[model samples]
Target chain A: MEDNGRTARKRAQILEAARPVFLRNGYVGASMDEVAALASVSKQTVYKHFTDKEQLFTSIIMDTTAQVEGLTKMITATLDDDGDLARDLRALARGFLGAIMEPELLRLRRLVMAEAERFPDLGRTWYERGFERSLKTLAAAFGRLGERGVLRLDDPELAAEHFVGLLLWIPVNKAMFRGGNDLYAEADLDRLAEAAAGAFLRAYASPDTA
Target chain B: MEDNGRTARKRAQILEAARPVFLRNGYVGASMDEVAALASVSKQTVYKHFTDKEQLFTSIIMDTTAQVEGLTKMITATLDDDGDLARDLRALARGFLGAIMEPELLRLRRLVMAEAERFPDLGRTWYERGFERSLKTLAAAFGRLGERGVLRLDDPELAAEHFVGLLLWIPVNKAMFRGGNDLYAEADLDRLAEAAAGAFLRAYASPDTA
Candidate 1:
């Protein structure tokens, strides 16, 4: 058990060190020597943890998806309860905006997209595990709301798509293209969250509530 | 004047040849030898027209933005006239969807994003000339609609952002990550466009129309 725990800790350290390496230098340009030095391990130890750079990079990306689990839980917790629908939605939007727009996350996003063509499975897996997982969670919550008569929607999945679309379209694209997060202030994100929530309510709220 | 015409033709050929090479090989991987050979010109001629690979790449990306002029014109032509707003909106959405989802364009998008960090100015220029230019035109049209009392909106730019976010959020991401255009069919795109138009109307249409 002690041996296993030590292996796990070393594995975590390698991933933590390798993520910024990949993010900064890109997949093709990133070097194993840099990863080993950053992790404070020998190259042989790095190879023991991961057989190749591809494996190491994939582990780093998959590790980021764990962050999405928190978001999925937030979606369920916020939308499943009996509460003010718009208020819950706006808060949920704010949570999502904040999570996705982290500078590190943005950098990782660029890295994934940058390497996506070279590693088709990496892109596909990230999309399924990270992006779609959150959307699916949001969709299920929206479906429940639709059934509960708080929201009126023919398709919960489509509604969820629009919800995120409205919230993320501007800032996400800006950060993706511009390579930084300074474009929007905290107040700007809040306003975007409110606007997305407001538009969603306008589109989905039951007639009486609307 | 004859020399100038020949020079223009050779420059165009090099550009055409260079685009596919850069798209296929990526920035760091692309070779000027391949570009010159493909264009059936001397390496000297290739360099004569464009000083370096960066210049060639930037020119190719910027050249693509000329296509956006058609979209901007469509926005004005469709929205300016007093026509069926829903129908016009759906048509415009369809146009945006079709133009952006072209397989070549998708590939170029991935290329620009991949090189975004390496060539920050290229990404910024593409975003400004290609992405923001379209949004600005759409916003102006929506602004006109709001003033004409055909739509209700406090901010036309935000409305424009929401409009695209709703229309593009799903398919664009899918294509970008999957690295293919086959995920969505013609029918699927039309359906997405119609859905976006319907949702936009729900959120923005005048109450009298509602």
Candidate 2:
């Protein structure tokens, strides 16, 4: 049992170190030697945890899907608030912007996309597990809102897509192309969240609900 | 006059050859020697037209911005039609989707974004000249529609952003991550365009306009 615990701890340490190395140098450019050095572990130990560089890169991306669990909870909690719908939506959007705009997340996103062509399965898995999971949760919340007569939409899933599209398209694209997250001021993000929520309500809100 | 014509012709030849080379190998991996060999021009001729690899890449990107002029014209022509507003908007959306979905253009977009960190100025120039120019034209078209009482919006630019966001957020991101443009069928694109136009009209169309 003690040996197993030590093995698990070493594996965790390798994963933690691999994230930054992958983020800094991308998949093709990152080296296993660097990861081993950064983790302060023997190179043999690093390979023991991850069979190869591709395995390590895949492991790191898969690990990030866990981060979205927090976002799922936030979406469910914020959208379920008893406050005004607009305020609730604004808060949700703010939460989303805040979560995605983390510098580490942004760099990871760029790295994933940069390598998407080379590693198609990694990109698809990340999209399905991390991106679509959040959308599905949001869609369920929107469906509940629709059923309660708070919103009027034929398709809650489509509405969910539009909600995120409106909020994320500009800033996310800017970040992707500019290679940084400092492009938007806090004031800018607030205005964007409000604009997206406002537009969403205009399109989907029931007259009585407003 | 003959010498100027020869210089212009050589420049065009070099650009035509450089596009494929850059697409196959990203900025860091692309080579000037390959460009010269592919252009059927001597290295001296290639250098005569472009100062360095960076200059060559920038010129390739800058040259593509002219393609947006075609989009601007299409927007004005399509939206200014005497046909039904919904039909016109759908057609415009369809055109927008078709234009951006070209395989070469998608590859170029990935290349620009991939190198964005290393070539901040090139990315900024591409965004301002190609991306923003199209959005500005769309905004102006939306403003004219507003003035004509067809659409109702206090901010045309925001409406334009929403229009594109609704239409493009899914497919563009998918392409960016999947590294292919075949993810969406033609029928899928038609459905997406119609949905976007439907949502935009719901949010911004004048009540009497419909």
Candidate 3:
């Protein structure tokens, strides 16, 4: 490995700084000067690595997937590890919900969503890096679960989408509308995990009929 | 009966004028001058009716609801008359989906959701007028269906939430990020509606093993 840890660290700092500016000002409104000031880096340093604002945003989103890719590896690895499926699913839900709710992450999403009319490619990139990567992790987990005779599912991908949809939608949508900040607390998360897991079992689990 | 027809029409005109400007310039950025100019009314005329920007916006939103409320009533009434549950649901879904995708409505929604962080009351107004009202309609329909023995449900409210969640989440979220210009065509709408209704039944229909 080429010890580029310092460079990685700087890049992380820049990305973190850029996120709020992009969120507050949206894509077309945000300026490099504000991002540089927030990151405490010189404008020359900011441009040295990224070619443009789009490229900088593209990098920040890629960072999101890098994180997803790591967790995905472990989620797949644990499919046969004797972990409770509900626990595993809950952990995955927690991860997904947490990712979607990060203030910077939420703002990043809003910025793309808000600017999507004028900037389709930004939304496309964010979706490709964020949601698609998470879907793959869930799909892999479902495939492994089916193979282990724990469940029967014809389309693992759709099942994954449904499961993840439960994890997100309500809390995330409410947050998008400014209604769920206090609602997603610890008990709320537990309720979400239970509701999602129970409903999932009701639809897919073999007739234990419990 | 107080017709108030001209007053209603003038209010409608004001809302139509206000919605686009608010979408383009955001809540704080938009000015009454632009709203008045767009409405073809004098700035004095604008102020004569609504006292301030907040009240003006609230009245515009309420008036918009009074107008757009007809779509839901039309859909629900048509479904109430006669049709298979699944077919009726599909038709309602198509109508509902189409209405939301209207360019002007989509833009308005984004403006409300975007500025929801700063002015929370606007977001609450949106939920009260839009999402909550929609959810309540679904619950009422399902409640009637349950009583008629066409369906079985303990909580139609959650079921309604789930149904709305599925239909609205993907396309609406996509629109939130990408604008609603190229949503499903007729054939796509049919397929989506059928799929949604089918998936919903698979989970909620009464136990047939009896």
Candidate 1 docks at the CAPRI level of: medium
In candidate 3 the C-alpha lDDT for residue A94 amounts to 64
User: For each model in turn, which proportion of the native inter-chain contacts is also found?
Assistant: 0.70, 0.52, 0.30
lDDT of 1 by residue, B7-86 (tens): 88988999999999998888998999999999999999999999998899999999999999998999999899898999
The residue-by-residue lDDT of candidate 1 on A1-210, one tens digit each, is 999999999999999999889888888889999999999999999999999999999999999998988999999999988888889998999999999999998888877877767887889999899989999999999999888888999999999999999999889888888765587899999999999999999988999776
DockQ of 2: 0.69
Please write out the lDDT profile of model 3 over residues A102-125, one tens digit for every residue.
765665566566666666776676
Provide the TM-score, chain A, model 2.
Answer: 0.96
TM of each candidate vs. truth: 0.98, 0.95, 0.83
Shift in Å, residue A123, candidate 3:
1.0
lDDT of 3 at B121: 75
TM-scores for chain B, listed for all candidates? 0.98, 0.97, 0.85
How displaced is residue B136 in candidate 2, in Å?
A: 0.7
Q: Which of the two candidates, 1 or 3, achieves a greater DockQ against the reference?
A: 1
Model 2, residue pairs in steric clash? none
Candidate 2 per-residue lDDT, tens place, A1-210, comes to 999999989988999988988887667678899999999999998988889999999988888899999999999998887669999999999999888877888778888877877888888889989988999999999998999999999998889999988889888887877865579889999999999999889888998986
lDDT leader: 1
Off by over 4 Å in 1: none
Report per-candidate DockQ: 0.77, 0.69, 0.42
* lDDT (tens digit, per residue) of candidate 2 on B7-26: 89999999999999988887
